[model samples]
Target: MINSSAFQGKKAAYFTLGCKLNFSETSTIGRLLGEMGVVTAAKGEPADICIINTCSVTDMADHKCRQAIHRMVRENKGAFVVVTGCYAQLEPETISRMEGVDLVLGANEKARLIQYLSEAWTDKTDEENGLHRHFSVATKDIKDFAPSCSRGNRTRYFLKVQDGCNYFCTYCTIPYARGFSRNPTIDSLVRQAEQAVAEGGKEIVLTGVNIGDFGVSTGETFVELVKELDKVGGVKRYRISSIEPNLLTDELIDYCASSRAFMPHFHIPLQSGSDAVLKLMHRRYDTALFAHKIRLIKEKMPDAFIGVDVMVGTRGELPEYFEETYRFLESLDVAHLHVFPYSERPGTAALKIPYIVSDREKKLRSKRLLSLSEEKTEAFYARHIGTTAEVLLEKAARGKAMHGFTRNYIRVELPSSQADEALDNQIVTVRLGDFNSDRSALKITL
Candidate 1:
């Protein structure tokens, strides 16, 4: 057993690799550790304990997680390693068996990490064994919603109001990793938002596995949650991370268009634009319905930023089907695209389907969609070249320039002469200028 004093005054370093929701959870964990007298390790400082929050979205993601774990063990030798999150829940035994992992925490157990650590640190038998082998994972149908908010970054907070997913897309494992849809009461989320504001946050991005499925247990809708969050004072802006196409209602679009707090930005996932591929993937909305949703958002708020998620080379996606998807996306008025090459996951229904696209074809298709994304992004930026919008400045600076994002999600870079470090979290009006040479960002006319 580690003598209780062995942990005294030791720093802990947290490494998180995944979505916005994971970041929110990690920040919350950091706060909890702070309250326990365990401070976060400063940059380049090795700590006595290291916690890794992992992701398992794709095969590459899994490989990255494994590589991080092995690298951490090699660099921070003898440091107590704790692994948690979706990957841990999926493969607890495998993680615990790794060279230096002292503890492994699953989904429900992750939030209570402090308590687990307290218990393990005091238990002599756990230390004698050199590993904590046995662990409990919350059932696959978790109902409890643990709200999280990121801090330390004053410009934006990723507020996780919802958790889990009910839509089990054939190619996805999130339903098994995250569990059924659930959320806390609206009152709880509003309080969390208020707390974020109290901590000096200027913007809050609502995130979840399936946020549109929120309020299933509380009889509250996503729209209702948005309305309540808007009532909270001090937070100048809020953005929804991503929502399924079918779940993004017309009312939400209209409300955001006229909202005083909600930003004019929407990230909607249209995984595949080909109706045939979408049907095979078990997506609820078809191409027609997805198109109509985009049309409505554009019609109501023409200048609103609309970002889409597109996955290429899924199982059975023929060349013609890919072309169909390409044509569909090209016809849409989206501002940006997140292109992904589909990776088959173990135990997913996608593995059973025949006609799996080859790696060469997957890479080729991904390249095409990425090029299309660039063109669409340039067109979107060009549409607002001369317009003025409020930009929330960020801290990063390149030599004498600072960067920020407009309300509609256009990134702008300007000379530090016009933006001082003191204006990091403040929103300022700046006329949009020409796109950068690469078309990735815009120049601000201050």
Candidate 2:
């Protein structure tokens, strides 16, 4: 039990590094703490407690997480530092040894953060070095499902529909850090979505490590879950964060095309477009199946905005393989490409492969893919010019321009002179105008 009085008026700082899933979890944690009478520390104000949620997808991600931990510690001075998420779950000792880190929680222990904080504050001199570490003994033991629906500092909510991944891809460490696939019942998720609607969330993004692998534990299907969410009242829009190609069924695509709230947007991970590289990465689907999924979506919804995840320069990705991937991607009708250079993760099967792409080669490949992405994105936006679309406006800083996203996920901005915070979170019909000055978003006219 926590002494609520002791935490009253206490200020806490939160820092999240990594995916939307991490942000959702961190927001949930903040909400939990808020219930105990703790408030978020304002900028430049030293907090009494600091929580950091980290990611460990790649070597660069890990490096950034470490840097974040150190900077938080320095900024907060004597704040009781707490670290959790994938990186802490994978390497607790490393984070625990960092100065001023008072507690380290893991995947299994995150849900019990309040309880742990209670214990820590109650017994001031409980452990040597003043560090308390609690994590699952192994990845398999991380089975508890922590449901989260939060909209931290944003108009749109992020609902965590599923957690953990069963697919242990060759170049990934997610399965090791997050454990096996698991999810709550569909009814529970629907209730959470309703709760989000009650909290003024008009849009929701379903987030997960392996969303399509949603029913491994519940025996329900992802399509079934989607159907249930579509019926939830007050949610004007919903987007599937990312789904694997093999699990993105035709039935799901068809439902989104005709559903009441589902958006005409999809983010599919096609890590490598080359069949050989896919095989080497132990991906379940081939290039042919991936192309079929893309075609299916386009057939059902012609104006859909499709985004792809492509990794350049992984193990066994010879020059020929890279070219194959580039050519394959060029043939696809995706609107954008999220290109990342492969970083070797420890304790993965990728180490067994001998071929390695040099740093310079990786940069070149990444640059080429990025250029292709820009060309495709510009074309996609150009096609929508002068067209009418409904955009969900977001709150903007005072005296600044307001921005929002269309049903198809196109970002559109309103001029600063005409925009005001009064129109925040309202869906308005606007004519898409020319590209903004930066080309990052399309300007709009009422």
Candidate 3:
């Protein structure tokens, strides 16, 4: 088989389906193909090949995947479509059967794509014809690790130190989709982290489905990873994207409180405040534990930004239970909320359980929680008013001002500047001003 190097002038298009991790992976895929001299092209024009990095956090993801494939076929009939990632890993047969799918590489087999596709392309002329290839594992525990994706445009980078999950919660398909937990060695992780910092990233966000589970592989733990990243060069701040309250330790919290690099921000998932509902969801932690974790953070860093991940609709969660959840959150000092109206996925215990929350009810509950989030967030931000906070100025957002984040993760928009200092990871002291009408962020003055 000829190397993809033979297709020096050929084009490839990357379509990423999900979170920041997926985006990072897609960018890396493009980068590798670019190094092989196969460059990515803008959409609409027919590319010789296409890579669709898929996701399957929900059933809607499958629908979107199919929709994207159909659109690709319509746009460029002869383009080769290589499907990989979570959805591809779980339902290789389903994706393989899709029209125009030439290659289907599962989560574990994705890295083999360059080799497989290169061989296929060299021997074939019809790029749109689906290839006879599928790679999937029945048991996640024994699956191999395959890393894709790379860092991004910000002074901040997302290093996927871990992959897959061992927690087979009743409502989750992630363990089946992503396979067992596997991560890079501490030395490898530090190499990538340092590389990101060297590449001009001023901050790095530790990203994963379960970052708290990061260092269970090595003798080192997630807490130790934080300490190591603190010592790395050029990185000013480190943020955890989302962590389980149960896995979040006091030692880690204390480290963040004292560390110069770790940011004072915590995003903990609290599926339910009702013990009965929490039990049904199979979450490891209860309201008491979650609340205690929050208390610990606030006790250590009063100005910390606390974000809660709440699922509005789930089985066994009665209206009273929702009120319990709301009241529990209200009792805390959380600054924001990420509300997900529980969407049922097939093959999950939650789907079979009776009395699922109606879409309307889910919407209502989501709205109610969001309102509380507004009040809590505004109150938290209001506490910092009339004082100056050190902010990392990001590239401008919208029209008029430069945008960045405060130490506590409060996004602030400052008056735009071309002093060359306000670009990228420039740290500047900005005075707090009035709230932006959006209520999503703050407008500040430099």
TM-score of each: 0.95, 0.98, 0.92
Candidate 3 weakest lDDT stretch, 10 residues: 415-424
Residue 130 local lDDT, model 1: 43
**lDDT agreement with native, every candidate:** 0.84, 0.92, 0.79
Residue 109 CA displacement from its true place in model 1, Å: 1.2
Over 293-372, each residue of candidate 3 has an lDDT whose tens digit, in order, gives 99999999989999998887887789999999988988988999888777777788787678778889988999999899
**Residue 231 lDDT (model 2):** 93
Residue 283, candidate 1: Cα error in Å is 0.5
Instruction: State residue 200's C-alpha deviation in candidate 2, in Å.
Output: 1.3
Clashing pairs in 3: 25-149, 155-201, 155-202
Identify the runs in model 3 with alpha carbons over 4 angstroms from their true place.
Answer: 43-45, 123-128, 396-400, 416-422
Best-fitting candidate, scored by lDDT = 2
* Candidate 1 Cα errors over 4 Å, as ranges: 1-8, 122-134, 138-141, 152-154, 397-400, 417-419
Question: lDDT score of model 2?
Answer: 0.92
TM-score comparison, 2 vs 3, better candidate: 2
TM-score of 3: 0.92
Largest TM-score belongs to which candidate? 2
